[model samples]
Target: MMNKPYVIGIAGSSGSGKTFFLKSFLNHFKSDQVTLISQDDYYIPANTKTREENRLYNFDIPTSINRADFYKDIKQLFEGQTVFREEYTFNNPDLKPQMLEIKPAPILIVEGLFIFHYTEVNELLDYRIFLDADESVALDRRLRRDLIERGYDEEDVMYKWTNHVVPSYQEYLLPHKEECDLVIINNTDDPKVIDEAANKISVELHEKNSTLNII
Candidate 1:
């Protein structure tokens, strides 16, 4: 019988550089050693009402995700089942979504803004990591991403940032941050900081996995 995969939950505010950190961390391991399941892909499709309402949908809220399905998929992974999901394109018509296949591995990483907010999902995490950043810096990063990658206007981005993102972050994410196993502050442009954090985490995870006889 195979040992259950060690599950890690990574949470942070939007534009907190979680993607950049994850990329650096993954470089230390082979493809088969770790598998990542992101909550971004589990967003519920926005209804016609939201589209007609000037696209003011609050995606930053926990209800925007299909939480039941996300939790079910994680349980399936723990049961040694492979799961497949469609990539979410942030309503970008220019980008085509791809079919994502997630295989069970020795280490499973669950990343998102609200992973810690969902009770069932939070309970499954063996380790939790919170990525911290200054509000101004995160907002700037968010603006660039929404403007360049998602093709959003400045007005819309600012509207969402002020009305949606900040509230949700304070209510859901920040409250549980103190309970996390690790906290990484990523407010700087220096790649060396991210590299050092990733290297330390990689070494620790390797040691833990070895002890569990799962690597």
Candidate 2:
């Protein structure tokens, strides 16, 4: 992979503090060196809307997204070519067709629940990370966020997590943690945790490149 961007994936069951870990990684590096792309940003609008309507969507599954769009974004980044990124709308929480400048940075962090399950997404990654978190805690956090942000009631949020998210995480996300460069069991609530991870990431990258040179 000549001139390829160094892609790192941070994954966990929803509410497993994947965001928290990503923020921590960001803290170590300056904005110019690190850019973040999330799988949530590439979701299929129709499926998300259906979930919003009948709440029948399996959000935790990798199939929740349109694979074609996901492949496009990753291919552009993987090839070290610049591309624009679309952000996800929380109000609608649907995928928006959008564009943002993406350049080759020192590190590119991609976080999501299903990052590994998607073969194309995984192929682009140089490093992968998974968070080990308790199911009850993850569910509670999901409930709170859904109620406050999405206007979903407690019952509705619980239904999706139990039916769609949890099962999918077990069946898909869990098995792929082994593919990552590191596995983070998120237990800290401190802001410093991110700093620590970022520093470690830098060191690991250095070590990897050094070994590659030795080859």
Candidate 3:
């Protein structure tokens, strides 16, 4: 039986279905038992740069994130303290964030492209998950997602994918998968894969609690 909350770090390349898997995983339990902390919420607060400058910003890199704040918030959750959830607008640059209160829970999920890229954040995770997807599939999914959710045009999406997103994944994100305890191959068509992953986590949590009780 562990005394602290169970922290799971889910990391993967863009368009690897990390969001899809997370949503599915969270569906297994009641909302009170779990909380999600997304690294996307910590992106360097709306900068004053121009549209082209913002477009040129390498969001895939570690520097694009305010890691210190992210670490502090997660650490607070670990200490059974409340944190304010930072709301990030996908395509809005000038909008200020709306921070909402987030209560601690038994299971805490930290998901992002660079969840494992920062040493401090990686050390705090009780379990790590890496989602793998084919480059072709990932590219297609990313293109579609950016177009609809992020309001990026085809040319811009392709440019960013080929230039920043893919390169950053190869340089920083992909190698960190070696540190993860579980590697999930995210096939967009398979719901069973998500279901199985959820069950594995549930069983592990139950077993850990049982052991802690015995101890």
lDDT of each: 0.88, 0.70, 0.81
TM-score for all models, in order of appearance: 0.95, 0.82, 0.89
Superior by lDDT: candidate 2 or candidate 3: 3
Tens digits of per-residue lDDT for model 1, 1-215:
35777888998988888988899988888888888999999999763444435458889999999999999998888888899999998887789999999998888999999999999899889999999899999999999999999877898899999999999999999999999999999999788988898899889888886554546
Best by lDDT: 1
User: For residues 1-35, could you state the per-residue lDDT of candidate 2 as single tens digits?
Assistant: 43555678888877767776776667655566667
Candidate 1 achieves a global lDDT of 0.88
lDDT digits (tens) for residues 1-215 of candidate 3: 22467889998878777887888788766776778899998888545777787677778888988899999998888788888876887656445668867777788899887778788888888899998889898899988887877777788888788899999999888898788899988757577887788788876776776532311
Off by over 4 Å in 3: 93-98, 211-215
RMSD of 3: 3.0
* Clash list (residue pairs), candidate 3: 1-212
